[model samples]
Target: MRITPKVSKAKAEPPLILAIDIGTSVVRTMVFDRLGRAIEGLESRRSHKIETRAQGTSEANPDLLLRLVWDCIDQTVAEG
Candidate 1:
């Protein structure tokens, strides 16, 4: 006779809220609960650089920044 172990499914979690932060050099996203706590294993971020010149001017690609934010948010949402 042979014996096998059984596997169990994970329990459902409570509802979560989405949070996004855009900064000068990076964008990030995370899921949080009502208590203002970030949920574990549900965060994403992307690094970016600001364009600068010798004249002390700086800027970044608006479209690229938007896409990075969107991608991180989408990934975090799918995690919860």
Candidate 2:
């Protein structure tokens, strides 16, 4: 007797667009459907301390900010 492996099909998800914003102190992620409306109850934000300079310049680590943006995107997709 030969046994066959069963393959599960992937479920179709609604079209979504991820809008990301990187600010000096926060990174925000939001998901919208084709209708251009935010999916209810689905959003992500990452807030971190920024480096302040004597000249009133504020900045954040590039690598850290990129990772935070990715994190927010991932969370938004998962929740939406």
Candidate 3:
């Protein structure tokens, strides 16, 4: 987050950008500035497992994946 100085000592804040990454085994969320630079303190991550079968097939539960993504988003926003 970036703050600008003003005559009255009040700070002008910049617009925030949130980024979410859902990978094969992990979900991650982070906050970034307009320039796409990540903010240092706003981030969340969670790992999930996929169901694998003996036939070399693997699957993930859609509901569980969605919930994990939402949880990451919520946690990251709370930090900001």
What lDDT does model 1 reach? 0.75
Worst 10 residues of 3 by lDDT: 4-13
Backbone clashes under 3 angstroms, per model:
0, 0, 0
Pull out the clashing pairs in model 1: none
Tens-digit lDDT track for model 3 on 1-80?
57622221122135666778888899898776655556776789999989999999999988998999899999987866
Candidate 3 positional error at 18, Å: 1.2
Question: What is the lDDT of every predicted structure here?
Answer: 0.75, 0.72, 0.75
RMSD of each: 10.8, 13.5, 6.9
Candidate 1, residues 1-80, lDDT tens digits: the string is 54322221132244556788888988999776655556676789999999999999998999999999999988987875
After superposing candidate 3, which stretches have Cα over 4 Å from the reference?
Answer: 1-13
- lDDT, candidate 2, equals 0.72
What lDDT is obtained when candidate 3 is compared to the true structure? 0.75
**Which sections of candidate 1 miss by over 4 Å?**
1-15
- Worst lDDT run of 10 residues, candidate 2, spans 4-13
**Pairwise lDDT winner, candidates 1 and 2:** 1
